[model samples]
Target: MTIAIRMPPDVQSVQIGEQAVVFIDDFLTEPTEMVEAACQSQFSPCPGYEQGKGYPGLRATAPSEYSLRLVELLEPLIKINFQVPEQLDLNKSACEFSLTTVAPDRLGVMQRTPHFDSSSPYHMAVLLYLCGPEHGGTGFYRHKATGFQRITSENLQTYSDVYSDELHRAPPKPRYFDDSDDHFQFLGMMPARFNRLVVYPGSLLHSACINPGIGVCADPRRGRLTVNTFFDS
Candidate 1:
């Protein structure tokens, strides 16, 4: 089978505080067939996400040839936006097809609130939207008390302490965080679009704006399917 690949030209990027969310349109060329096949196959429950009823989805270290090709296309953008080192450590990266397994009402504390992918500023996250807008988008937020949108290694402890206290003070309501409350200020939002890829710092406080009305399906073809990846340079 032949895969069609198109290189994006001068992608647009939006800056949110210390982080940038680069948007790449037409990220993949005809990826539906491959994605559907993967979704229909067996997928193990993702650890640490089960409590929230979040779909575990599948992960693969050995990516397909098409995925490797896409990486090559993304490298230039990463180097420019993230200022990544010349030598990228692919060994630490994997491709994940995330599915929303949990319902909004069933979300746990951590799942209900926004979270950072990592405390390290050097780490980056790339989320490729494979589904439509109904799957929901992503939102960035700032801790009201700390005025911090991105937690770094230096402030991780402090942020954690403050966050824990805030949680204790007012437990999160059973639902996905949609807007700023007394504790967090909503910074920005990135709408999910088919074949759209968003690249941002892993340290940014963000959350998936899940549409609770839509039953979180295990099928990648119909669910909130996304290719979530992390990179360390």
Candidate 2:
């Protein structure tokens, strides 16, 4: 179900399951500009993923400038009475934010992998697309029994079995195979538009869908440029 809340004249909020994703028309003007600056600044390689490296990125260059604006705009939605406890703290809440530029090759393997978020109930994630919808969109899913929806690559990294290429690599997990009849129920897909931000429980199961019939290097330009953060309540 889609529920809408007006933050004011131009900004709006939408809640899907336990996740609250807020959208601000021109709210990201400054933050977007900051991100562009970071992309060119002395960037850092992303922590775990070898395939990804953030140019100086926002996390270091001008983090306070980049995050304060986002925190301010999202404060209203964060203060709402959500079911998850980790997403409720207003005064003590903290988040890890970064700028990401996904190369085309990495996006291919990601599409076929289904993963879970390992964060406990106290953590949620927000992803802001700095690019356009044509790049790639965020996919959300509802896990059985768990009821949690809207997953991302960050969530899958929690399970060692999923990340270790050698363990579950060659044959693939039985559950992920077609014959297993295992499939995630689609919760929703976040639009990949500039300034479009998607926030959801970090523990949800989600993944990025690969562009069909496209080679990794065919159009390296087709990948996504996103700024993401993980919040703890």
Candidate 3:
């Protein structure tokens, strides 16, 4: 079966504010075959997190073909200074890709687990999704002074420029509201759209959610395919 993948028009930039999350729509190049091949290739499976921690993410060493394509795609964003690179050496290998698959309709598993990438150091965290509204959506949240609430997926979703509702409200009390002194509040929710890409600061706190309507059959038959890339700052 041939899956239809559509790439949006070239994006300028995807930035919101100090909230810590940003997005870049249509962030891939033509020749998506390389990326597809790399994503389908075997790599180490992330075991996932425990009962009281964050979500688990798998990492893959992106193939050169895929990496080169990514660099070309990102050059525009970099040239306009829409995105700042953490490295001065353009010749250095500064990109790595990973794929995170979220099964459909598994809300219970997703909502409960919130997380941030713990990998050593990556300038930006790129989340390029290959699923449409019929499946999962990417939600953005932020770390509040107290607890974390849901935020809007504005710059990420490509639907609207609206932001999260919770951020504007006054900080709530009750002191012991959440697990940590700081919690990630929701910013925007990206309704699953094929070939949509969300790029944000690697230090930001974020998480993923299942579609809640569809169901998966088994491994490799995922409802959403989230391709991740960590680039040198």
Candidate 4:
């Protein structure tokens, strides 16, 4: 099967906290191929996100071609919007289709809070929602203690120190984090829509706002299936 992205992707720009977020609708000419591919692949527990920390879900490999074309098509926009270098190496990127399969009982304390992927300014995250609004959307947050909207190397230590102190005082509950809490404040949520693509900095404090009522469904066609890619230099 052939894959193609929409020409001059219907891009919209927005700010989530201090990060530049790009939302593209009708991103692919054949998005169902991605869903079909996910339906066919075997999924496994989402392993350690950082330093062997458990993530709340299941994940499977995605089509490499999708990753390649996505970056190629968004090159100019990414440079201007994300404020990155002109050269983006797809070889340095990653692609995956993940399903939010964790139940509250199975969630880890760390997985219940918002997280930044890396401290590097160059790192970026691109996600394509393959489900309906009922599945939920992605949210940006602010660390209430540190007032950190986007954690950078200069403030990573400060953020970490404050977060560690809070973690011990009161561990996060075993459930998907929604709006606000004592530690993190939700800035806003980018609603998930079928075939909608969203991108933001990896340093932004963010989390998936998984719907509690839907529980967990492994079926890609029915659950919160998403294409998550880390695009960087």
10 residues in a row with least lDDT, candidate 1? 53-62
Clashing pairs in 2: 42-56, 43-55, 43-56, 86-122, 116-155, 117-155, 151-205, 151-206
Give per-model TM-scores.
Answer: 0.89, 0.60, 0.56, 0.93
| Residue lDDT tens for model 3, 109-158 | 33343444532233456666655566556555555542323222322332
Tens-place lDDT digits, model 1, residues 1-233:
44455554448899876678998878667767557656565666677665653333334332366567657777777777787766765323777667776766667777788888888767888888888888779999999888889899888999999999988988899887878889888888899988888988889999888776762777777777787777766
RMSD of 1: 2.4
Assess each prediction's global lDDT (C-alpha) against the native: 0.75, 0.48, 0.45, 0.82
Backbone clash numbers for all candidates listed:
3, 8, 19, 0
Residue-level lDDT tens digits of model 4 in 1-233: 56698887778988776667889998889999999999988888776643326556789988878877876876666778876766655334667888877677667777889999988887778899999899889989999988998989899999999998888899988878878998999999999999999988888999899887773777899888998887666
TM-score of 3: 0.56
Which is superior by lDDT, 2 or 3? Answer: 2
User: Candidate 4: what lDDT?
Assistant: 0.82
Enumerate residue pairs that collide in model 4: none
- Scored against the true structure, residue 168 in model 3 reaches a CA lDDT of 32
Query: CA lDDT of 165 in candidate 2?
Result: 43
Runs in model 3 with CA error above 4 Å? 1-9, 12-40, 47-63, 75-87, 90-113, 118-122, 146-184, 212-222
